[model samples]
Target: MDIFSNHKRLFLLVILLFGTLTVFVAIFPALNNQYSYEPLPDSIPLTEIEQRGKMVYIGNGCVACHTQQVRNVEIDKVWGSRPNVAADYAGIERTNFWVNTATLMGTERTGPDLTNIGKRQPSEDWHLTHLYQPRAVVENSVMAPYPWLFELKDSIKITEKDKIVNLPARYIKDKSKKVVATEDAIALVAYLKSLQQVKLPDGTPSPEFLYKREQKKHGANESGGSSALDGAELYTNYCASCHQTDGKGVSGAFPPLDGSAIVQGIDPTSMVNIIMYGYNAREEYGEMPAIGQINDLSLEELVALMNHERTSWSNDAPEVSLEEINKILEELKKQNENQ
Candidate 1:
């Protein structure tokens, strides 16, 4: 009760109080995150270019549309094999001496999740085309095109490496100007290629989506029959977003699948190749990503998707067999090797 008598005692108590608060604020997060640490296999540190690309991605507001965190929910099967864990991002390099801005785990997902994008969509060509003109690849994509990242197309002095994007014909502003990729584009692609989740630690079981898989098995058509569930279901799951339910894709964005000549063509090889390899046939239409290949669809599933597209919209093409699809895929592989 004597105010002046305990001044020294009071000063000591204040120091202790502030010191404990500082420790709680700074040290607890590191300790709390420690328990979640598990070494994932096949993990690699980011390179200098990849780090620069990360900054580009951050600067461009990619986190606004796409999320880096994969939820534990059953509906998140399309994103990755497992929900995001702390160790998946354990290898993220520190920006400065005391800063690590790699964890952007955004909540909003206007676009598809990017947690395992490097695994799901690893092709640099695809990203380049998509980045130059999002609508060029993804019909109805509201994403802004980064044309500054590329040069106009011109045949005189450009190699395949310099001209990575094979844009659809309709979007070309000037035919003389061949689009060449800039360093920022390469950096951005490298950064995106690094955004993958490594496998979970040992003893931690992988997330099994088979439970929800069957429940979400699509394809209850007007002309329903006992056909394979994997194809129709996979088509809806993987391709339906861009191509649409009726297959009459958005105008000026995605090409028509309902009664397309490509769909109804005699040789299934071309269509099959397109599904597996991707296309930039017309500049007007958006580019098609290699849906079958990227999604790892089986021969039977690719056949199923082809058949379903053919039969639907009153455009009946002959049913494609797995044998035929396999042949087409093999031939294409050889051609790629030859080239």
Candidate 2:
């Protein structure tokens, strides 16, 4: 009590109390987070180039718009296979003595979440074009173009190994010139491509998305059993980025799904096979990854997707049944086994 009257003693006591509170409130929790959580067993740490790209991502203010987080709510399920967990960011480390690169879980969802973008859109060409001019791939995009990340070259030299970006004629200012990605752009794309979510260990049940919206079987067709999943919504989330909403994919990059004979053909063997096994059209277009397989799409979801593609745009084709897709999947599985 007498010490309270002395300013020096009172000041010392206040400092001690502040220090104690800081230790408990800030330092301890941070230390616990750093030590307690571990990366998922299947999750790979960022490579050297990817680390540089992470720095580029921070430097370009990408965190200001795009989020790396996927909330547990149903609405956020489209962004990722599952919600963000502590293990997801466990491998992240500080950049240096000053910068904390441990978490880049951005604040706003101004742009789509990048949690599973690698699996969703794996095309290097698409990412490069998008980086050069967002509007080239995404019409009506508000994200500013990183033109500085690209260099315009007159022609590809036979000796130099330069990866030319595939840009639409409309976006090209000089018809004679070609655009190539800078090292920064390539690194950034590498970082984006590495953002895939790893699968949980075998036999381990994945966390369910909460508060799922109940909707009628709107993706239903007379030929096919009604799907609980909305085909249009699924297409928008998974396919629309490369194959435009119009079903006409980006020229010289993504082939148009509209008016495709394979899409409208009675035999959905090729369509289903392409979805399940992926396609390589790198000669003229980007390689299509095995999206259905990667996402572990359900039979009902596959039916919905096939039906959506078959019927959307100028395409007018018979919707494939769940049984049909299941049969194809079985056949494919047998072939894989034989191989």
Name the top lDDT candidate: 2
Clash count, predicted structure 1: 15
Consecutive 10-residue window with the lowest summed lDDT within model 1:
219-228
Per-residue lDDT over 246-288 for candidate 2, one digit per residue giving the tens place of the 0 to 100 score: 9999886688899999899988988988988889856677678
By TM-score, how accurate is candidate 1? Answer: 0.69
Candidate 1 lDDT over residue span 16-75, tens digit each: 989898889878877777666744776888899998898888888888889888777777
List TM-scores for all candidates, in order: 0.69, 0.88
Worst 10 residues of 2 by lDDT: 154-163
Instruction: State how far residue 72 of model 2 sits from its true place (Å).
Output: 2.7
Candidate 1 global lDDT = 0.74
TM-score between model 2 and native? 0.88
